[model samples]
Target: MNVALYSTPRFGALKHTIQSEEQRNSSSGDDVAQPPSSPSNNSSHQHEDAQDLLSFGTHCDVKDCRQLDFLPFRCDSCTQTFCLDHRTYESHKCSAAPNQDIRIPECPKCQQKIQRPRGSDAAAQIQKHIASGCRDLVLLAPRRKCNHKGCKNTEALSFKCNRCEHQFCIKHMRVQDHTCSSQSIPPSGSDAHRLAKPGQSALKRAITAY
Candidate 1:
């Protein structure tokens, strides 16, 4: 019988044997398990869900019409929304615009020129006249003077209404009818009076009255 000679395993052969043993051990149920998710796979799933969630009109209930890009301003008179093309047309005139020129006279809805009753125009004219007269009185009254000792200055003692001739000092001219019997007496001569100069007194009186 012939016998073979036995030899020690080389370093590489020992390493390979050790690796094989490790691989077998790792395959057993006692080995640490890896997480099922991968970063790439998770990102893809998240992206798909985001796309589903971002759909704009899915929540809208309109059966056929989509959301309008632009909305129209509704006319108060006609109770209708006017599109851009029809906004400037005479048939859809804006009632809010001041009709100072009276060019667009007719009501776009009823097709009637808004009329002021005959006396209404007269009443408005009278109001404007009264306002102008009041302004004139305010402006002119400052030029008149009272003959009283302390009131001798050139400034009007009060505004005397042209119609009423009611005299009110410059202080009372704002609201009180100047023609009323109440006489606003100036401060008499005293130390307190001296401390308050004519101009200062007038200003203080005006402020107080105001």
Candidate 2:
């Protein structure tokens, strides 16, 4: 019997078979790696989009709309938040409960529609109106000097002495401090208190409007 040599042609076929198997394995590994990477990246992006939508807060109550905000209009009748375009029940076609009345009343204090009260609050409304008027009064007051003779203090005229009938600064608010003329003072509870300073007739008119 003839013994086959280890480095013979038949043995070469064995080597070729092993090389082909390695090439096929490497090609299969590359294909698997590439497909998995693309799908994983796409899935991660989709997940990120979903998370963003959730963090963006509630959308408008109206169907087919997509306005989202942190301070959206909250409807008292329907108990839902909405955007500017659909903030009202009629505009959004909201399904409010029975006898649910909807109103987007302006705030009496701020005069802004954003801070609407849920129900009718007469006391709160009155207070808000009074406060708003007071703010306007403070803003529109004139700038003037202390009515005291020979004094050079000039600032926003805020107070008028009841005894002196002259506008003075906080530093000289007392009648005696400014040597005020008591004879020229108006009677208490008179409309002359509305006069801020001399030659300021506009202020009296403004106060009468209140």
Candidate 3:
């Protein structure tokens, strides 16, 4: 019988086969040891997370137009949240629009329109204007009547008489028309000119030139 020794060809062949199996096992173990890297799966998960975050926003309240708005506006009259297109009361046709933006206060003494700014108290603004001496009170004041005795005319503007220095209506504005108190007249032309009104001398000069 022939015995196969350690240095024979068959022993060498068996040792080579065992080494190949060990190398194959080591290669498979290395493949399983490292983690799987997929860039596409990571990017897809990130995109889904971003969409989930953006979904938390308000929706429009208009009928047939419920679009999502990240930043909504609130109407002042209706007090409802809306988008930019329907933020105004007229645009949305709000029911309470008529009662909202009219806050002008009238002056009790003058009956004139007082300008009241938005967000200001109406009563406080009126009180402040009254304390500041309302100009309409002086402008809308009653005109003084004629100073002539028993004269009932109060519609025309009063004029000052040059002779008596008394205010009268247009009918009695001339010195001769009313009671003349100054009977003495200027003797010289310079004296008459000095006594004449500022506009009377200019009017006379214009008339003479024309």
Best by TM-score: 3
Best by lDDT: 3
Judging by TM-score, tell me the better candidate of 1 and 3. Answer: 3
Models sorted by lDDT, best on top: 3, 2, 1
- Of candidate 2, the 10-residue stretch with the lowest lDDT total is 133-142
- In order of appearance, the predictions have TM-scores of 0.20, 0.27, 0.38
- Residue-pair clashes per candidate, as listed? 5, 0, 0
lDDT of 2 by residue, 31-51 (tens): 876444678888999999989
**Least well predicted 10-residue stretch by lDDT in candidate 3:** 134-143
Better of 1 and 3 by lDDT: 3
Relative to the true structure, candidate 2 has a C-alpha RMSD (angstroms) of 18.2
Quote model 2's TM-score. 0.27
Clashing pairs in 1: 144-156, 158-168, 166-178, 166-179, 167-178
Candidate 3, 87-158: lDDT as tens digits:
656556677665455767888966766776544445555766687777522223357787777786775368
lDDT for every model? 0.47, 0.66, 0.71
lDDT of 2: 0.66
Model 1, which residues run further than 4 Å from truth?
Answer: 1-23, 29-31, 48-170, 173-177, 181-210
What local lDDT does model 2 show for residue 24?
99
